[model samples]
Target chain A: MSVIAFAKNWNGKFKNSTFELVSYTKALANQLNTNMVVLSIGEVAEEELKLLGNYGADKVLTVSNPQLNTLTSRAYADIVAKAANSVEAEVIVLSDNNSGKAIAPRVSVKLKAGHVAAVQELPLSLDPFVVKKSVFSGKAFGHIQIKSDKKILTIAKNCFGLVANPCDVAIEEFALDIDTNLFKVKIIQEEEQKDKVILSDADIVVSAGRGMRSPENWTPVEELAEVLGAATACSRPVSDEGWRGHEEHVGQTGKVIAPNLYIAAGISGAIQHVAGISRSKCIVAINTDPEAPIFSVADYGIVGDVMDVLPRLTKALRNSKS
Target chain B: MKILVCISNVPDTTTKVKFKEGDSLFDDSGVQWIINPWDELALTRAMELKEDAGNSVNEICVIHVGGASADATLRKALAIGADKAVRIDACPADAYHVAGQIAEYLKENPFDIILSGIESSDYNGSSVGAMIAEFMDYPGISSVTSVNLDDDDIQINRAIPGGKQVLKTEAPFVAVVQKGIATEPRIPSMRGIMMARKKPLEVKPAVELEVLTESIKFELPQEKGACKMIDSESAEQLVELLKNEAKVL
Candidate 1:
């Protein structure tokens, strides 16, 4: 039996999340006394694939079908399921992102494997194959056990940091016939966000809410984010009022992020909002209300008006850097 | 055209999470149940489409895989504008099991369009929609923000990592929707609520399926310590703390 780790790429370049996944599955493979094989689909250069070996992949299996460039859930699942069956994989792992959420379940159905998503830790017990995951939108944790011999798990973002364990790695091509008929959904157009830090992958995030008062007063927030190289986020009300795009809403219903540092300005910490940012390594909250719920979870609290505080903070950071 | 919206009965968003049975199960005592927020939005969008005369949508049905207690949630869905309700009589064991039960039902009773939330607020698995699509061999779209029906073709807009993706597909598909699907969920009117009680709520036995995962225990996240207050005038001090004390900068 072997372990399979699905590696994802964007324009043939692997990101930090893919490296973290490979490192995580490598540790799991070691614990199980087995070899870990990294699987890549679509286009990725040989040297870029070899970088996965630095994180402990015993071998890399890749399928370079140009038709596979765009993700079709059914076709990707079919390829992953076939790869798992070929190696008689006991465990299959994928990142708990959009693609993984779409494809992992289908793979589980194909393999008849017990599946878990957003798993936060390695198995607690090998005998029962138990792992821990967040439930209730990170309000609590659940220890889940997979009963099937074949198991599929999607690792949560930023849960397991990257670790390098270089080793001799072999690359092999996995051949599969392209079946374009399964591509039922046809993409008509694509709009890619340019020259901005993706919220899910950002290490530091600077966010605000209605306390900024209006959308026009967002210059300070954007200036601070630009100075710190952080992504900007907003509360639900901010998005609901059309002050910011819905994509910038970070909360239980929106994006659940676990950045290294999260700075909230002028936002009253609602339970739903707190649920999303509670995983950040450090939280700094600034609000006029001393009793705001956000202060309770924050590592540092500042009681002041956001308009006054934001510019001051931005100036301070700029001065400190200069 | 027929539309099936999958609903999940979850605790209210403000409900404090607690577990009973030696931490093996969620403690439901005094916990008010409501339709999963995302599912409610999906149902709201379906209702909107059905209300538009230009669309061919005729029937709107809601389905849930749970025990009898979830019937109230289904009624709530009906009151919010579903034409009928279905309750597969069984406890939802896991995502795989729930998707399987729904897939089995659809095999015998197929709908033109199937809608589900991107993830349930409770378990937050984000799996059942695609799994159902796979099981039924239908196209599945995730992170869908807006779904429109132009004649018989379905146009969908979804949020990708950096930007948005626009796609087109036919009927007999699953669209897993998120926040922007509907601006707001509709509240049930007095007349609608009265009529919901008389609406058809068919209960069917669950098909046999293998249970894949089991929960062994549940625990709350660790409590954070008291916040270290920083003087508002001294903004630079906070930056120093971030660089020296927190080491995040």
Candidate 2:
């Protein structure tokens, strides 16, 4: 049984998600004692495909054609399903990005496999392919198993560290003659947020809620995030009030994120919002309200004005490195 | 453009989750249900499109796969201005079951475009929408922020990691929307609330479900550790405690 990973020839450059996914797929494949095959769809440049080897992929299955290049869920699913069937792949790994979220379930249905999206950890059991994932946003953890032979999983971005495994893997072009009838929808356009790290994959996220009280006060939050080289996020209320863009909103109804380090400023950790980001490895909450729910989950709780605390923390970190 | 939007009835955002007598079922006592947060996108976008097309969006048919208490959520959709609504009348406890029921209903009526939330709040299994599209063999995009319907194609602005994509798809496609799709789903106005009463509320028998998950038992989460506070006076003391007690620097 082979392990298949889906990479892409995205906009002429290798998408970070693809590289990251292949890294995790390599880890999982190693654990299962199986060979890894990375599927790079569409007219992907050969140069871009070479990065797969650096990212731990063994054999890259390049399906470069004009029919692809757009986000066709069914087309990719049909191709992946056909490839996995041919290779007798027991597991298919995908990035939990937009394309992965769109295609994982559909492919699972085609293969009649157990499907899990937004998976946060590598498999604890290879026999059953059991993995851990966030549930109820990030409020809790659920361990699930892919009972079927063909298991489809969308790994949460950055769940595994990017290891630079040096290898010269072969890039073999394999084509799946999938029928066009498979795609119910053909994408005309795709949307992306402006010039910022996707919060879902950010290593460090500095977020603020209503306690900073005004949209004008967002500068400090942004400043702290800038200092830490972290993505900036906000509470649901902050987004609702337009202090930040909705894409910057990180909470239950907002984006479900599991960044490495999440710094929350002036935000109370409501269960709903906490349900989204509670999976962060290290959480530092800065708030004047000791009674705020944010303090409940914080690994480090600083009870002071976020405006006052952010600059100090940012300065301290900068100073220490100096 | 006739739109059929699917919404789920879920426990409100702040509901303290608890297990019932055996942890197999969620405790229903004092549980306040609201329209699933994700499904709000489907409902609102349908309403907005209905308005934009010079009222060409004839009917915004809202549906759910659940029980009686779900009517409140149904009315919330109606109050938000859906022309009519239907509940599959089944508690679809599994991903396949809900997809099966929705696909069955969708088979009867071919909608121009179907919208649902990317995923529901409670289950957090985002399988239903894609499953429905897969079952019905319909084309779909997800996390769409802007959908501009052109002559034969639908120009959709789908949200990705860094920015948005201005992609287009033909008619009869499906889209699972995120929060950015609509003007933050309007809190039902008094007029809309009154009109919702007069709107059609049809309840059908629930479709038979094949439950795959066996809930062994429900248990409350481990209670949080007691709050540990250090003297607020000096940063040096706090830093010392953080490194030693908290084991984080």
Candidate 3:
């Protein structure tokens, strides 16, 4: 049986998260000595689809349907389940993001596969098929054993690196066996952020917390992100106070982010907040309080006012770029 | 409108996690048990919707897949505003098993709307809500921030990576809500507490599940090392360190 990885598409292009899934799934499939197949949903250009081979996909299945462009959980799950069955997949892989977390369970239930979410590493033993996952809101790790022949695993964002390993990819067209009534819930509105790095796709993120004070002070944060070509995020309280939109919130209940470099300005790290970014490669904390909890997790910390440090950091980045 | 809200009894968020017996068992010796925060948020939202529906909404039933150990949490839910409670007499082994048990219960007693947290704080699996919807062959929506009842249709908004999207669906739907679904969870008052004692707390045996996953061991995350502290005034020096020393820049 083959291994399947579903690659999500948005704005007529594959999401960057798919690459990470492909890289890791390829490694996993190799461990099982199976073929690595990627299922790309929605409209994707053939040339862009061919790039999947460079990321280690042995074959790419593109499901091109105008009606399937938008994300409706039921319809998407149906298509994924059908694809997995067609391939007779033993394992299905997805990134543990909003879309993945939403769809993985439905697909698992449909395929009767054991599902494991927010997995950090690959399988430890192929016999029992054990995997490590974060539990207790990232306070601890648990080794889970999937006792089923079929399994579904969702990797945490940024937990696995996207390493390029070229494979021969044969692109195929997949016609979805969709039920006509699946379009009951239509997406009324979709507001996309154009010309900006997607937060989950970014390698570097500059986040702020309540220490930033108000929404107005967020300008420097944005400016710093702009200079560094990074995405901006906020702590839970910042979003709760209406200082930032809930979409920018990163924590246990919010979006979990892991990037190469995560810089926090005026953010005290709560266990919940730290849990979200625990996988970050490097962390830098900037706050006036020397005893702030963020420092314990930071590789480097500056005990200074965010207002004083932000402008200087932005200016330094601007100078270096110019 | 009939609504079923699913809650889980979890350790308090601040409680330190400890494992015993080769890291296979969660040590609950002195840990304080409370309603899972995420489930509390979902419960509050369900209660608010019931209030808004007024005469149209008849009851808000809270359910849990646990043994007598979870009755306290069920009582707390009743005090918070649930009309009744259902305790499936079983300890949840995993998310799949829990979802299966909840689905088995839901099949017997159908409801118009099924609401639950995105996931329990302890496991952080974030799959039970969607799995239940799938098992029952209902439309399931996750990361939902707001739910507004428009007669038979329910308009919901959910979060994405960098934004949010709005969807409109009819009844017999499942919603997995997050923090923005409710501002705060309701605290049990003295009068409400007294009345909860009289409220119905039904206990039902759990259905057998074809459990698929098992936990083998647990390990704590590595302790972080000493942080490299820099002077507050040395902003340029910090930048130099990020570039040269940390090499992340």
Name the top DockQ candidate: 1
lDDT of 2 by residue, A95-214 (tens): 887788788878877777777777877886776457776655655456665666678888887677677786787888795576867655544444555566667667789888888888
Query: Model 1 misses residue A126 by how many Å?
Result: 1.1
Query: In what order do the candidates fall by DockQ, top score first?
Result: 1, 3, 2
TM-score of chain A of each: 0.98, 0.89, 0.95
Clashing pairs in 1: none
After the best TM-score superposition of candidate 3, give how far the Cα of residue B220 lies from its true spot, in angstroms.
1.0
Residues A1-322 of candidate 3: C-alpha lDDT, one tens digit per residue:
9999998877677656778889999999989998888998888888888878888987888888877777788888898888999999999998888889889999888888899999998898899999999998888999999998999999987677788998778999997577877767767886667777778778899999989888888989999999889999999889888898777888887777788899999999988898778878889999888889899999888888999888888887777767
lDDT, model 1: 0.93
Measure candidate 1: CA RMSD: 1.0
Cand. 2: chain B TM-score: 0.87
Top lDDT hit: 1
Question: Per-residue CA lDDT of candidate 1, range B1-249, in tens?
Answer: 999999999999888888988988899999999999999999999999999999999999999999999988999999888999999999999999999999999999999999999999898888999999988988899999999998898899988888889999978999999989998889999999999999999999999999999888999999999899999999999999999999999
Per-model DockQ: 0.86, 0.38, 0.74
Cα lDDT for residue A257, candidate 1? 93
Q: Is the docking of candidate 2 incorrect, acceptable, medium or high quality?
A: acceptable
> Residue A133 error for model 2, in Å?
3.1
